[model samples]
Target chain A: MIVAVIALGLLAGASGLLLGFAAIRFKVEGDPMVEQIDAVLPQTQCGQCGYAGCRPYAEAIAAGEADINRCPPGGQNGIAALAELLGRDPKPLDPESGIEKPKMAAVIDEQSCIGCTLCIQACPVDAIVGAAKHMHTVIARECTGCELCLAPCPVDCIHMIPFAPSITTWKWTYPAVEVKAAA
Target chain B: MSALFPFHGGLKTVRHKTESNQTPIQAGILPPRLTVPLRQHIGAIAKPLVQPGDRVLKGQMIGQPDGYISAAIHAPTSGVVSAVDQQPVPHPSGLSDLCVTIESDGEDRWIDREPVDYHRLHPSELRQTIRNAGVVGLGGAGFPSAVKLNLAGRSEPLATLMLNGAECEPWITCDDRLMRERAAEIVAGLQIMAHLLGPAEVLIGIEDDKPEAIAAMTAACAGTSYEVRPVPTRYPSGSVKQLVKLLTGRETPVDGLPVDVGVQCFNVATAYTVYRAIHCGEPVISRVVTVTGQVHRPGNLEVLIGTPFAELIKQCGGYRDGVERLIMGGPMMGFALHSDEAPVTKAANCLLAAGPAELAAELPVLPCIRCGACMDVCPANLLPQQLYWHARAKEFDQARDCHLFSCIECGCCSHVCPSHIPLVQYYRYAKNEIWAQEKEKQRAEQARQRHQARMERLEREKQEREAKLRQKAPVRTEVVPHLDPLISVPSPTKGEGSGQVG
Candidate 1:
């Protein structure tokens, strides 16, 4: 019994060391750029970029599988952010993702909704709310401004208006301030 | 402001700077149509001051702000707003943004515009008028200048209005040229800014690399109280924090603004805009952008916010061949654009048409060797390698502890990375993952709240129905808990196949 136990212990220790050494030997160097490209991405899960989410897009950027301009949600800021991270020249956003447009959110007029929950089920972000046989409402903050909920609604009660910018949701845009004439 | 605070993380990558700074800043001729996006400056999307059918004069206010934080959008050219709908804007997402398309009227008529003579107005009045003119920080930060000028804080104004002429990013020459050519106006703007933010001295910090800019600025500020100081040419010497450190010898505390050290820095361009805003009745409608890189003709062109990249590129004689990427700013910290269709925004200082020949065909990214090169030049003092590890492993908790949020995404790490592991990309992914997860968590919490409410309502209604049923049958007493008959959840199988929870 002592001989058997000693043999088992030796095997286990040897295996552990082997595994540790293998990990260091086979270690792959990772690109640290994925994070910066990711930051410029819109946190929206709206897979408008064809990726499941922003992280996937970041992965593609790091992997060179995706173009930085495909993110419609991140807009120019995202593109600039990615360009900055990659040490590449900042470019215009890709036209394929979609053009930069006024952001909008879904709104449901309860008066015309007729208690249909069609939009509730269709919403990828679950922004549109209401149950069957009950009036529906839109949770604006939760809405990704993707406009997905509009098509699913059986009645034409849903409308996507221009996104209203409040103090909290607003981000600063660089001003076009021209330099002065030299004194 | 560096008091040797030992900011422990960052990388001083090879500053490529081979293209732009080499040439004397040149201006592109023939002004084209300028499509101005309404929400160019941050805050509320300004209401259109001009309609699609209305003929606007150059520098005309096309969009008016509804509130204080908002800025007015101006007509880049005296033309009709061709369209006032969603046009492709220069955003990373490449999504269409609200813009006023102006087909340029070749005349470029100067509408009754007057420049503010700063000496005539009181400092407070000058600030208000400048705010009314909608002048904001020309630096990429894009902070509202009015708020910065009117310091609600009780601290004595001890900082100098450091005019940043050090165009740190290699290919961007908008500020450098502005300093070189328009030194007097820039100085005048600086003087105005100083008067408004008084007790503050005027220190125009130009990089030693641009001796012409330094000489011009020195010449401009000779008779005025403003002083043109030349600093060592560093990659980010123009950064407000770094310049502040060089000038005042004070370190802005982490997570604190330059104002914390009783200092406020303004870009030289911003000062120039202040001068124009106070002097001319012009809102910040147009800006000078460096249009260079792999193009036939490259020069600095004054473009209106919302001018399409295609137009700008066309004006710059277009790309020579193999245009790989279209970036909105300099190579250091700009966006690699997807299309040439996106319009210029207020923030776009440079437009680069770099193809695979210059930008290079993207190679596969390797892994981080942990040489700690990224740590050497990080202005933020963040452990980028630690962040890279946590991000790759999806261990966001550890990344947060490493101060993931403070990373300015300056691309310093990626620039110095030997293995070409997009270090910044990893950190970005981690941050986005965490942010997405947070949003998901919030959504989940919301769903839970809704579910809980529904459950409570169901319970209350069940009790109410039971109470009603009691009035009908007093002797037979079991309250029916099944709500299948009351609330019918519809199923896809049609009305006959109802979702009944028994």
Candidate 2:
């Protein structure tokens, strides 16, 4: 009886020491899952996910504090990808978030005056470039169509325009009716 | 005779060649207007050289080839440039594309012509000449022939130079007629290609159904090393991979081309055009098009590029009664065009005016019963059921893993499907969606890279600004050091006193 008890006690101590050493030696500095989730995000930084940025929302989702379907810009495709990655059931996008739409970019009207630089400050990606009381232009390639700058612009010169399909971007639509007779 | 290697599954479709191949090739009437799409060949759209009101002569280069993979566009006949804007093109999308409309002057004048000595010219020069002449694969692929002749820049010796005379598509008889009528010119083009590539052997694979075409080609190939081999008639047997397999007993590797196996194939019509370009100094402005099905005078017409379909149909006695749909290419792999107003491009081989009896009737789509009919006819040997399931579910990655890209979109699976499912359409949808996703991923990556670059530039600028400020105000740092002792002495004295007490 004594030998059995001592053997059990020794085993427990050894396991406890090994586990403690492993905890100290192999501890990860940051949740890698959060980084993975952040990489998959559209990275608009629109704060529609109730977080300040895409990284923070990814962190929240990784920490199990936020749902994966909160991002509207990502749409159903994004939700499905996230679900696949996290090994969870896919869900529809939350209705509270905005609906998914075609990719768009912000275009600024140069004719409008009174550049107060409010929009420049509001832009999260620094896509807009201007000085005080001067004409400002949005870099169409850089603008993610976040709409955060739209409200801050006093002149309301900013407009989100959907990308026009060029010859290269056009894809063939599915045939409406299948031919049943063989030629 | 070379031993033939059979490919996977294929069907023996009915031959409708008797309708169109019964008569000799006839020249099409000149239309009042020609609306030529800039993107006739597969790659980049040709750049327009003429604006509205510019008078262009016949065979005058009006649209320059944009890049390496593009083909030059020419005015089909002497005409004034009416407009260079979006016009209806013969595509499955039913959308408009940029086209150059020419108003015919009826003169049909040709530009100054001079044949080139291809033997004396360097291979690159020959290729450039061919490119300038706007020669492309007339087998409906419309790939720039110069690009294919360059052998993808591989130095390995070419083994077989195969000429495709296998007009396996049921309704298309243009190639067959070309071989029968213009066999000598096609052989001359083949000799030129052989001179360029120096392949060990030259073989022309024509279907046995056209015994006359095979005999003509064989007689033309006499006194030369080129061999005319008759292949079994089968649907899609004229496809480059399948033809290569049939003639050489070699299988093209998945995700690889025929050239990788030291074989190169060209259509018989493409060879004829090459001969015309090199020997006659004429660019590709017209081709033999099979105008059959529901037309009163159903036969082959050597039609000019950019001639509207309506004008061609008028020459063929117009559409007969019960004409339901107009299709471009063969009935098996062709797409239903929206309007007869669409112009004929270089890629169009046949303009099928399908009637009720000709086209498949619109039937209610039935669910896939998993009867394995599609599997039995799949030329690529893919599991159509699995592909359909995954593609319908938008599981593209899984579909890709099943060698989705290898499928040639031959429509064999859809043709044999008992359930009436458009298997080819599903495969096309999945392929397109995957391409779209890949493009999106690329754009996202580029954006991320740009953002990182912008951040790095900003940080460097900030550091540079600080350094410049320090350079501009050297006196401030000297003054600060002198005043530092006065501010620091009391604090150090207090610290020293505390240390002594401790």
Candidate 3:
């Protein structure tokens, strides 16, 4: 009886030591869930999710503080991706945030731009370029179509123009879904 | 004759060759106006070199090649630029592209010609000259031929330099006429390519249907190492992959090129243009286009680039009665144009004005009854039904796994489908969707990087500001000692502050 107890004790201690060593050896630096959730985000950085940015919102979600549907820029597809990643039920986007819309690129009316740099300061991605009191323009290719610049423009010159399919960007549409009638 | 290798699932499609090939290729009439799209070839659109109202000479460089894969654009004839603005071009999307419109001067003047000796020049220099001359594949896709001539970076030595003379698409006889009329010139171009690529052997594959072209090419290739082999007349046997298989028994790896298998392919018409570029000091300003289908004179015309399709039709005695949709290519892979006002591009092989009799009747698409007809006719030997099912369900990954990219969009499956299902359209949709998703992912990654960079910048600025404040705090502390006496005097006034608070 004594011999069996000592063997069991030694095995338990050795297993505990191994687990402790493994914990230190494979220590994760940060919350990987936050990074994963952030990766699934569209990264528009419009901050419709009530956080400062996509990362902050992702952190909140990882911490079970913020809901996944607060991002309207990500739209329904983004929400579905987030739900799949987080192992949560997919839900409709929160309407209070904003309505989902087509992809848009902000166009600065160059003639009317006041050159105040307010819109430049408001842009999160630094897609806008201009000096103080100069004509500011938005880089259409770099612009994430975030409307954050529109509100900050004192002159109301920034226009959110929806992108139209050009020859280069045009894509073939899916064929019509067939509905068969009963024979 | 070399040993012929047959490919799987090719239809014995109707040969509409005689209508256009009977007559000799005639020089196309110059229209009053020309509309040249900047993006005639694949890759980046050529940058416009001339502004509006600039007078350009024939063979003058009007559009400079923008990037490595792009081709230069030259003026077909001396003319004054009307506008460099958005205009309609012959694309399946029916969208407007930036085009340079010119009002023809009617002089048909030529610019100063500087024909280079291809034999004396290095291969790279020769390729540069060809690229500057705007030589591209005249068969369907206008891929820059100079880009294809490059053999650098390939580990294997080029074995066969195959020239595609198989005008396999029905109703298109441009290649046939070019081979028949300009066989020596085509042979000369092949020699130049062979010199550059240093291939072990040169093989020219002509569809056996065109006896005249075969005989002409054969006679021209006499006393030379070039061999002209006639491939069996099969629909899509002219396709680069199928032709490669038929002639060389080599299978181009999926999502790879012919060059990957030690073979290089070029269209015969492209070779003729290459010869012209070197021999005649001319650029690719014109191509032989077949204007058939419900036209009075259904023949081949050497149409200038930017000539309106309407002008070609008018030159051919206008459209016949009961003319149907105007297609930009052959009946199989061509798309209906929204307007004939769209100018002829280098890729315009034929302008098929298919009538009701020529077109398949508008039948309602029925559900697939598990018919294997599409699979049987697929040239790539892929399971068309499985691809269709996955594509229809938007399961793009599954479609990709079924080698969707290998599909050449030859429309063989669509032609044989019993249910009249547009199978090619589904593959195109799936391919396009995949491309769009890839672009979206790239954009997302870019946005994420920018956002992260901005955050880091803001944090660094905050740290710098805090450090500066810390540096200035010592001065403020030193000055605070002088204000100690004033602070002691304010201690008596604290009673007044407390009474006010109460």
Please tell me which predicted candidate would have the highest lDDT against the true structure.
Answer: 3
B-chain TM-score for every candidate: 0.82, 0.94, 0.94
Q: Please provide TM-scores, in order, for all candidate models, with all chains considered together.
A: 0.66, 0.88, 0.94
TM-score of 2: 0.88
On DockQ, the stronger of 1 and 2 is: 2
Which 10-residue window of candidate 2 chain B scores lowest in summed lDDT?
B493-502
The deviation in Å at residue B386 for candidate 2 is 1.8
Q: Which 10 consecutive residues of model 1 chain B have the lowest summed lDDT?
A: B493-502
The sequence of per-residue lDDT tens digits that candidate 1 reaches over residues B1-502 is 2232222333333444445545555544434566677776666778887777889887777787768677667776777668888776776656666778888778878688876677888767877777666677777766667767876555575566677787777677788778878898898777777777774577777767778889989998898877777776666676777777777777877778888887888888888888788766777777788888888877777776666778778877778877778887766677788688777666788888877655634555555667988888677778888887887776888999998987777777777766666767677677767776576556544543443444454565566556556555634433554533464332222232122121
CA displacement after TM-score superposition, residue A32 of candidate 1 (Å): 40
Docking outcome class, model 1? incorrect
Any runs in candidate 2 off by more than 4 Å, and if so which? A1-31, A44-47, A50-56, A63-66, A108-144, A147-155, A165-167, A172-183, B468-475, B482-502
Residue pairs with colliding backbones in model 3 are none
Order of the predicted models by DockQ, top scorer first: 3, 2, 1
The local lDDT score (0 to 100) that residue B133 gets in candidate 3 is: 95
Candidate 3 CAPRI assessment class: acceptable
Write model 3 residue lDDT over A19-72, tens digit each, in one string. Answer: 999999999999999999988888899888889888999999999999999998
- Work out how many backbone clashes candidate 1 has: 89
Q: Tens digits of per-residue lDDT for model 3 on B318-352?
A: 99999879998999999999999999999999999
Instruction: Give the residue spans of candidate 3 off by over 4 A.
Output: A1-18, A177-179, B476-502
